[model samples]
Target: MTPQDSAGRGLFITFEGIDGSGKSTQARLLAEALRGLGRDVVLTREPGGSPGAEEIRALVLEGDPDRWSAETEILLFTAARRDHLERTIAPALDRGQVVICDRFADSTRMYQGLSRGDLRGLVDQLHDLMIARDPDLTVLIDMDPDTGLGRALSRNGHEERFEEFGPDLQRKMRAGFLALAREFPARFRVVDGNRAIELVAAEVREIVLDALT
Candidate 1:
């Protein structure tokens, strides 16, 4: 019972976690593994995956974390999501391709919703209104907040705005993510991400392949 069924609609898998939890690397590794099996896979990321959304990614991910209010960030992310769905994710799924995304609405639910304020309700409202898609599976790579922060900052990436929020928010985000997993157990799978990359990836692959069956 692989993701593709009789109707051939395909699967949508998203990775979510605090920064440096290795979700991004796992996402890529999963995509490569599946492709090696000859599955039609489309690997993409949000706040990206489409041209318009990539432009918005720069706006949201760069600069100061305080640059945009939570409300404004929600709007920006929602707009990018709508464009991405229209231009990238939807079409790929329509063709019976597994779409593996680095992040999706859950990130918005965590970052803008819980961070800086209790705006989860607002985030859900926008999600239900403009972007109605949910991933078939969400692999949340659980990690130690301090270690995750150190790994994130070590990258010295331009998208350092969120990492610049420092370890406190990372701790909050990690707990919040675990809470989210509990809230959505059917689609959520938590993988310990503090191990060697290969071990983490092995568990991730097993979880996903199990879901496919």
Candidate 2:
């Protein structure tokens, strides 16, 4: 659905891409720009937006790469998303505030569906059964997997479960995200993310402004 078709309530915007695609940075930039324009904006991220969800995020992102089986990982992600929607997202939307999220259900679809296993059906089914709301506008920061992987690996963090999947998986994820954008053209905007941060953020700002209008 279009941003204007959100039942006249708040706008829900999400940034999506393979790991290290700079989606998180762009999400923050968009939130800052909208707030600068005097709009109420809530910045959040998936798998860890709320208290309970943050706990879930630790479980999903920590430990060995095979800490959880593919099916179990999907279930944990769904649980975290349910808590995020109930505790954080729903309240912000109710207050007519724009919500900028770093990642959302789409990440689960691509990471679990493509990276872990061929569980796209399971991802869709779980999302439909639990969290069915889609972002009004999803900005997909598209980039080459090799570059993205390099950027992601250069960072230091204990939450490297997904990043540990390496380059081949990252390539598959990039393709999956692009395919998802194609599946939801009206709600998805593909932004070239290989440019400088300022340039990419500028393009993102323009896309968000257009959606808000």
Candidate 3:
């Protein structure tokens, strides 16, 4: 393990990507690698890390697509995120344990912001006020939206509210993420996610190591 400074006790890392960009897979592999190196790691995902949030996740992902408005979706996501951060992420980092989250604030900014349009600044303001800490680093796994949507459809056997928006909306979602990364270049590292899993894992491992060292 790399030596830490007096204040650099724990590292908070977030994985962001459009659906089916393999963010979850990469996050899991990264966490496994960190654990193998004897580091304490907390692995979790957004919109459902805590028990309450997980229940919300099921509702958000399984409900009828037409039943939810863009604003409604955004609200639910933020609500889930607030609980997740409070119940799961904060405590792990406070203990000097690395937290590898599957999706974090970026998901809301991208999905809610782009698909839903401007929402009177609700998403950004709420995030600023609620989330206590920003991630130390955010790794964005990027892939073609069409390809990603196809992968998601094949894996899930159907699309949900947000997922059913089709390729165009998904493309815009990717753009939203790129915009956010650009808005915060120093903290974000974009990874080409169009490659095989092994290749992607190698790149992700290097990024994590670089951040830790």
State the lDDT of candidate 3 residue by residue for 30-71, as single tens digits.
989888877888999988999989988887878577667768
All candidates' lDDT scores? 0.92, 0.90, 0.84
- Top candidate by lDDT: 1
lDDT of 2 by residue, 1-213 (tens): 444343346889999998899999999888888777777889999889999999999999989999899999999999999999999999999988899999999999998877888999999999999998999999999999999988898898888888898998999999999999999999999999999999999999888878777
Q: How many residue pairs clash in each candidate?
A: 0, 0, 0
Any residue pairs clashing in model 3, and if so which? none
RMSD of each: 1.5, 2.8, 2.1
Superposed model 1: Cα runs more than 4 Å off = 1-7
* Per-residue lDDT of model 1, residues 53-85, tens digit only: 999999999998899999999999999999999
Residue range with the least summed lDDT across 10 consecutive positions in model 2: 1-10
Ranking by lDDT: 1, 2, 3
lDDT of 2 at 56: 96
Per-model TM-score, in order, reads 0.96, 0.95, 0.92
The global Cα lDDT (0 to 1) of model 3 is: 0.84
Full-model lDDT, candidate 2: 0.90
Which 10 successive residues of model 1 have the least lDDT summed?
1-10
